[model samples]
Target chain A: MIIYGSERVEDLSLRCDVVVVGSGAGGAAAARVLAAAGAKVVILEEGGYHTSFDFKQREREMLPMLYRDRATQRTRDRLVNVLQGRCVGGSTVVNMADCARVPRAVLEHWQRDFAVEIDTADFEAASERAEAALGVAEIAADQLNANNRKLLAGAEQLGWRRSRFHHNRTECTGCGFCLMGCAFDAKRSALVTLVPAALADGATLVSNARVERVVVRGGRAVGVQGVLTEEHGDRPAARVRLEVAADVVLLACGAVHTPLLLQASEIASASGQIGRNLSLQPQLPVLAVFSERMVSFRGIPQSAYCDEHLVFDPRVGMTGFAIEGIAGGPVQTAGLVGASGRDHKRWMARFAHTGSCLVLVPDQPAGSVAADETGRTRIDYALQPDVEQRIRDGARAAARLYLAAGAEVVVPALRPLTEIRNEADLARLDDVAVNPDATTLLSAHPQGTCRMGEDARRAVVDSRGRFHGLEGLWIADASVFPTSASTHTMIPIMAFADLAARSIAQARAARTI
Target chain B: MIPEIDRRTFLRGATGAGALLVFGGALPLGACVLAQASDPPPDLAVLSPRAWATLACFADHAIPRGGAFEAGASDVGVAGLVDGWLVGADSRLVTDLRRGLALLEWGPLLLGFAARPLTALPPESAGAYLASLTTSRLGFVRQLHAALSELCLLAFYSTRSAWRAIGYDGPIVLGLAESVELERR
Candidate 1:
């Protein structure tokens, strides 16, 4: 049964076999598996329960409704805007629906550098299950919108490696509003898949319930306690208290939040690695104006990517960058124009002819998440020197790609309106400072905050996602990734969560026996 | 060893001191002391009167009327919309924004563009001052400019009135006749 905590006037108490905090890709997947295994699971989601019907496809309305901190959550320095969903399905509900597995090199890096061991066959099986459940398939050739086609064409002209992305969307109406929620329900997010399956299997979901802390007794997590908040808005009013007693407590709040919850619960690791090693995988938007009307916002926003520049090292995993086709509504697009008054309006006037792509760069874990003096979450991330160079190189490469694709002018979202008319003008980017606020950078994939490994001195959770030195406490989200999972993290997160859930279920069965 | 002053002179000095204190306290209350002509929105929720006036002026300059579009941020009440959005935002963020707006208003003086505030400058001069902020040597100043610029652009373009000029057809979901397909597990 699904309960709207906002409607409750009295305090609530419940007992369950498993209490999962968060209802995103990981929490929902784990909840489904545990529920199917006959564990009485109770899922507590801090955000409200919203479905496709509630999606208005308007940026102003949907942003505040579906996103955390109204989609304004930024790093401590305000250099990177970290966008994560705060509604029922977490980020999976608002993501671009790109599905990818953890690259082999990344897995190897985890095993080599982090001592994180995973059975290859088991992981593959879990990934296969997730893909099948989500109806993951390659984007059909006809489904490539003008923006994506431009990306593919550019890569082809430059003889760069490119491919159509596999997505979890089916019967998509080509509405270009995926960054907002998908009103058509075509994107098979965790909200429509695992969350519903878990609920159908007798898992109880409480919406608008924020889990503040885990209740630990005798070195084991016994329950979780928090408050039930109002249904909507960035700062919802706390209405009532909520407590859930469970044999196992699973935290799947995204990388930034899961670590905060652990720290608030006083569950410090011996390694002091609770909120270290944050990887933002920041992406920069590059716009190209074409002669013809591309009408880029009519179809799927992101369907193809160019991986020619993406590099993978045996030691460090994924590095370098990948360029993916992207478009947004007028409001989001205007924010990237980097001009004011007439100049800005002139750019937006040609909105139909503008094609955009994001330069996705994978970086080493070089950030941390902590609470400030005022008790607000503070994500501290500054671009390292190498990452900044890579970003600049990536931007130049993207501009070259657009120029190769016959774009009239290529514009990287930078201040002072740095425009690349021809290949010679690409050098202008070198003079541009890639410092904070000098360019627009956004992070949709934030991982590795509370990383997983074998050593208690280095990792917050073990290989099986069990919190080190703590019994009955587990983590099953992107927070457990030892490094950057991939360019896209939905599928990898789900697969890892599936494996973690099975481990938890087996442990419970073993204890019962 | 004290020298005695005239009683009339002492009374005058005390009265003048009281007047200075009263005027000094009231000066800050006139929120937009530099731009006394502008007023805050009627439905203010979070922003103070000075912040509201500064933001409104910034919005006007950032997305002024009569360029490629007829509707500007001021025409769509972008500042008012942002004020409403800030109502539920984090208190710290709200405080930072208030300070940022104040800085923007007084930026003209600090940047040596003019002795007056941003709102007091002519439309062209105000636009130039805002442009100068984008390339400012100070990172926080540039950040403030970028923040307000983005907020104004987002708020302005989000309105339906700004759609036609940009060639957007708005959302298509509301007009769909067919039902969306659902695949159950």
Candidate 2:
């Protein structure tokens, strides 16, 4: 049953075998799997169950509905725009829906140092299942916009081995509206995929219930204490502390907020690694305008990626990053290309023919997440010299690709002064200060905040996803990923959540006697 | 502080140009509004006239006219939108934009000039002057262009033009075929 908001929490009315804190990719997946295994499940989601129909493209309204701080949640420095979905489906609802397995090297890293056994074959098998379940399929090339086609052609010309990405969507009409919440319900976010399935199987869901802290006694998790706010708003009409004693408590509140729950509970402090090793798949976009109408926003938000450079040797850090096709209208295009009034006017005029491409660079694991002075979570990442250099390299490469495909002008995320008309202009970015504040950096994929490792003293959770100090408490989100994968993290997140559920089910069966 | 947009021109973009054009057309006037009307047009009491004119021209350039585009920049009350956004609330962008606009040359003159009641000028004159600006002539024009570009890009990227430009085939427009698909699917 779906509970919209606080019903003046009757004392201990909620009881379940597992109580999942979040309802995102991990939480929703975990709930679906656990409930299917005949374990009564009650999932608590901080955001509302605002389906696609309820979504409006407006950021102000959608932020409160779909994002954490009305989607404006920023780091303490007030830079480094961090976006996360806050609805029943979590970021899954707002994600680009490009699913890729946890890279083999990332798994190997986990297994070698953490003694976690996520063999390549195991993840491959899990990925297959996830793909089938989520209806993941390549968006047909013919369905791509002219801009997407140009991008693909550019990558092909460079012989970079880029492949078209398949989204979980079955019905996509090429609307550039994925970022604002899909209006067609075609994007297979967890709200439509897992949560619906979980709901049908008799799983209980409570929306607008923000879990404040984990209830612990005798050094073990008992239940969680959370306040149920009024349905859509945050005014505390009535405060009810919820405590549901359960056999298992799964923390899937994602990387940023998950550690705060553990920190608030005063758990996982012995290792002091609760909120460390912040991984931001920091992305940079370069927009190109062609004389012909390419219209960047039409095709899938991210339809293709180049993984030709994904490697783990000493010289190269991680594999090459994925590239996404992006575009917007006059207002948006003007911002990127329109710095001078003339430039702004020209860019707006050419908005219909502009194509945007983004290089999804995986920043080296140099940054970390820490709670701020107000006890609110904050992520601080100083781009390593190499990472910034890599971004510059990627920008130059992307500009070349766009220019090769007849792009009139290329706008790199560097300085507005740095506009690329041909290959010659791309070199100027090498000297431009590509620092964190100077460039527009966005991170949708956050992993390794509450990372898992072999030792209890060094890692927050065990390889099997069990919290080091607490029994029956496990993390099944990207938080458990010891390292960031080379590709998109959604598929790997699903596989890990599935594996965690299977482990819990096995443990329960073993104790049946 | 930046100047105010001509209220007459701003209103044209708000309603005359069509509802969709309002987003980009009115994005720039917000940095520092200097409405001279009793108590400064609600939110915009700080901006001078020249800042408003720059904002007006900036909004005009952003959501441009011609090619049968019914909504001109002035249709959206682009000036009013800027005023509303600046004085109505406090945000990072609002604060930054205020500081940024204050840095412009002749900023005080523009702010003071904004207080006078605005009269609609010939559209051709507005267009010609806007067309004359170059990266070399006025750095402020370049700066305005950049800020306007960012604002329009944000609006365009987030608004309906993006969806239309991208060829979105969502179910919002329920045609006969769409209804059939909705029922059949």
Q: Which model scores highest in TM-score?
A: 1
**Residue A90: error of model 1 in Å?**
0.6
TM-score of chain B as predicted in candidate 1: 0.70
Q: Candidate 2: deviation at residue A509, Å?
A: 1.8
lDDT by residue for model 2 (A188-244), tens: 888888988888888999887888788787777777877776555422343465666
lDDT score, candidate 2, position A40 = 82
Q: Against the native chain B, what TM-score does each candidate's chain B reach?
A: 0.70, 0.39
Among all candidates shown, the one with the greatest lDDT: 1
